[model samples]
Target: MKSYSTRAMALIASAGLLAVAACSAGSGTSSGSSPGADQSLSIGLVAEPASLDFTTTDGAAIPQALLGNVYNGLVKQDDSGKIGPDLAKSWTVSPDRKTYTFELVDNAKFTNGAAFTAADAVFSINRVKTAWTTSLKAAMDVVAEAKAVSPTQLQVTLTKPSNGWLFRMTTRVGAMFSQTGVDKLATEPVGTGPYKLGTWKRGDSIVLQRNDAYWGSKPFFNQVTLKYFKDPTALNNALLTGTINVVGTVQAPEALSQFTNNDKYQVIEGTTNGEVVLSFNNSRPVFKDVAVRQAIRQAIDHKALLDTCFAGRGKLIGSMVPPTDPWYEDLTSVAPFDLAKAKAALASAGVAGTALRLRLPTLPYATSCGQVVKSQLEQAGLKVTIDQLEFPAAWLTSVFKNADYDMSIIGHVEPRDLGAVFNAKYYTRYDDPTLQALLASADAGDEAAQTEDMKKAARRLSEQAAADWLFLLPNLMVADKNVTGLPANAITESFDLSRLARS
Candidate 1:
């Protein structure tokens, strides 16, 4: 659920105390009235959600649009990537770290008029184990039991001590659902957050209306519109022409100069956990050979790819571990770009000139980056074919679900998504017991041990060329000067409309 198309546009925060980088020019005021005068605002984004039901859907788009704005979890991750209380007013963990007791807020109510209670928490957690179909549901497998000790108190016991279980709760897997509103999740979503579904025009936009009866402080905007655009030009045009007040994700990084030269817009540049990966299907006969994988990794010039595809606006991380993760390491040197070494590796594997498919989602970054990957691989004597699949629908079904791809390009935007994407059963089909063991050890170890072990796991993964990490996508946004509370770092899947306010 943390993975999305590169254009999905959600960024993440770092662990501990992470500083957010943001800058703007001109007066921070839109072409509207003063503070609290404009009660509605329109924002532009790419890659709209396939559906509203995240329990059955897999991509990050749903959670990016709905998580913090519509649904409230037991715990929420702040912009700093620190976990804090949300619906659960407070919580206590046992000394053993296997049990968690939560005291729920007494005043929270769902959009459907159902009062939120500990029983709803029980139902939601159990539903993840029983009915959720997404791969992200595996995060809840560690839970031994979820019980409502009282109407406003909930308890959950994990099967073992896990350093990541509580953190994962800050994701979509921890979203609380109402029993009464379960029937129409795909069409209508009801939650205890500050906003409710207003109107959704499929392929165009979704409007979220403020919940007058929300338990938390009311958000500044009475209504927020999330307008979708497949074409990056249209996305920018919407902001330039006043169709939207904000370009939530500047899809065309090269076009930023148009806004940067103008005094009406503020450009925010920050960091995100979104790693644009060149993933290989390990189950495929060609990729099953580690030598071939290594050759592929060594063939591409990451610096050149980043420059051509993203206007050199991102970082070359060389591994799945983004800088925000505590276990991060700069492993780009592990597989230096060497055409001669690449050819030698392919020849040793008896796969030189082997034909391979490079399927790509229609997301802006993938389509752009795939060309460079193909041209580079071909230079190393591999025959590469490019196939563009419609994003979220065709790409999610063919590549992400069925593993019907030799290789693909995607942006894994979820914070700390190493364990999920590399799972044996995941679409990558990367079944390595040693890697799995290291990840397990990292999760069960103490904070210091976890960091050390995770570093080893990441190094092992990169050394083996498990996947080619293209680069870390930068968080870039262009909004009207008046839009305040814009997060400098995208630390979670949610765009968090509640955080936005007019200056």
Candidate 2:
């Protein structure tokens, strides 16, 4: 079983990326204390140019926080986790399940003022089949071809059955970019979303105002500001001074301390199932054996991840399916820490005490997971070497796209649907045919059939160790008390911020 656990790296990192980008968010915010809630809103976030453009990592380069503001997909998911209509009003799947038809809404318009239609949807998917999609294969693999049947009707052809194809369409890659925007967007992007584009200062700041002519919900605030910060402390300072409105997954043990006496502030912390785990590119030589993978899993103390890195505010995970999601199989959550068993597994794989050097990107998720994991592996009898780079990218270049790492650490989110993580990684060298088959079966069935299929896939993934599913925890979203209408979506946070009833 090749462990595909999406430890916090992939999960919170995107939220973290928003925070990284928050440092300079206040750089030139009209230079004053925000006057009134009705006109302007400054939200804090951190983002690295995960991709300068789409060619970087998958077809979608921007983090959810940024993309949530600037891009509109066929459907929109709110921060509350509701999947609602966006560019497309409704869609129907063919009985054979190879085809998916969608009806586009009439009023949708791109930032450039071009009409959005079924043709653009087809263009987004089909264009990815070409050179524009190199980094996006894993995310785009299940999609075969996309085409339009009419000006407002679009169809998608898949290589196999896919129940969650529509959801994937709303992801970053799923956002529709103007045909004209595609050429100029490498530097200046144009999209159909709630907020219009503002000046994008690479290392410093980003500012946007509500698209008053928005097609959907009207944003409560007029101006939306995003800044980038390299230091977590500096970003927190913005929050302290009230220069920023919110911070996602920022590490501060005393975060409560900062907000204690402030009536205008609020803190939201809960248990989320997002976990961070290591993945061995099964296509690579050293990680070819299940025993070696098991040994690595056994070596780390997930509880320590919670204590040291999370400041005692997280859950330890032992499976690939997060508990917060319904499709998650209960059994994967049962692994107990057994150092002896882990060592035995390593010996079984003939990897005990062997030189196992790998590249790990240290960012977001639990702080110090890479460093802590390295120390644990050494104690478990593996010769460890560390090549630290930025999060997500290091793993992307080394494992998924280029296959350069010995072992990689990543945080994976078990999206609302379980099949997402599995389909992206299964048999892409992880080699568990059962897991792939279940996901394929899901695509072929109805909603109920799909859920059951995903549950079954969850079981297979737990058993196959496609990766450690890890723990289910709550997402932390801190905002000004004035920001109203925060929806209680399950842990699966949607990006639809327009519906938020801010004061």
Candidate 3:
């Protein structure tokens, strides 16, 4: 097995080969001698997990931040985004790529002490396939059926060749659960991971204890605590005051200097899949014109927007695909910053003086980003009024589902998939068969071919100005200097406990 450092270097070489391509880890913790044994570690979480039942929640970063510790999928991802054997000791794919056969790890036992087997694998896969709104259901829906060949063997048959089967397995949605364990899911969740749920106080914190009977290497700490906080400043203060041992994914980039400039902490930083976009509702007449959309894209300065919003924490992205993705194309050239050109294009589209209504939800970065966008659009001779919603649910219901607004600024954070813009069923208001065909072609073929196809599709999207590409959100992890072994790649889920040790 390759170390994370080696695998990460390979990942960067394969993904970012452009002249401006460079990868560096975020700084939160300091470089010093390791500390003595610490029995426990506490993390300040931005929000509580949506649901303890992994099958129900959307499995976004917040949900997976907690669920990742409590669940074990058939396979697991290493710190560097490579898939490794977990409950399933090994797996072989059929030549056609439609069937996958997995060999179970015989000694693997669920937290409830039930022996994990092929039946559990069949049940878990089918559960997600039938579940209506699972985050990974779209990907798993291709599974024709999952059956147990024997107590120690399982086979999954897919309707077509799915490139995401193995990648999806590394997520919590693919986590295996025993029948008895799932029965108590609402109150107590059980899995084969290193940690078991110890206690839960709704809206407060979740406590996890080491599963001593774990089949793999155990965690160094006896217990782990996840503390929830809605405020980034509060979370940073906690880390500084020693109320929490670590802080993962702090939303406010302004607070980063508090840890980055300090010598007592270590910070691991890198780009994540959360590529922010200035989405235009294509159904609206004002934005329906491609000229207007392209004008809007060129109007806002990517550098100024990212600098004002995240204090220059992340890099400018071209399409929905972030720079961290292997298929990422530096299409920033497609939409260059030209306020005069933007103004001319808007006037040509006959919507130059219209005050477009921009509706935004109050996420950590939304308000500031929206404000900057408003200023830039106004400068480009496009009148704009900003309406900020207090809650994300309201924004989703009104702006996304109902199409109640003209435009909005938001970040789409799902990793390794661009279904948000490519899939017709998703929230994008565009209805183009040509673009859909290009996306399908991009998703098919061998690895190298897929990379070329992805670049083609990304370029097409950029040329058409699919969505106003803003910037790729960066992943930052801050911890006490004594802590170690944080993953250096873009994955937010696999923050493995076994990797951490206070020196």
Ranking by lDDT: 1, 3, 2
lDDT of each: 0.81, 0.57, 0.67
Off by over 4 Å in 2: 1-38, 59-61, 78-83, 94-99, 134-150, 155-161, 260-262, 270-273, 332-334, 364-367, 391-396, 414-429, 469-473, 486-494
Q: In model 1, which runs have C-alpha deviations exceeding 4 angstroms? A: 1-38
lDDT of 2 at 318: 56
lDDT of 3 by residue, 135-254 (tens): 346667778989999999999998878676777677555788886677657568888887888998876788888888888766777788877676667888999999999876666777
- TM-score between candidate 1 and the true structure: 0.94
| Pick by TM-score: 1 or 2, better one | 1
- Candidate 3 stretches with Cα past 4 Å from truth are 1-38, 183-187, 390-392, 399-404
lDDT tens readout by residue for model 2, 359-397: 655454433566777788788788888877554455445
The prediction achieving the highest lDDT against the true structure is 1
Candidate 3 to truth, TM: 0.87
TM-score of 2: 0.82
lDDT of 1 at 219: 80
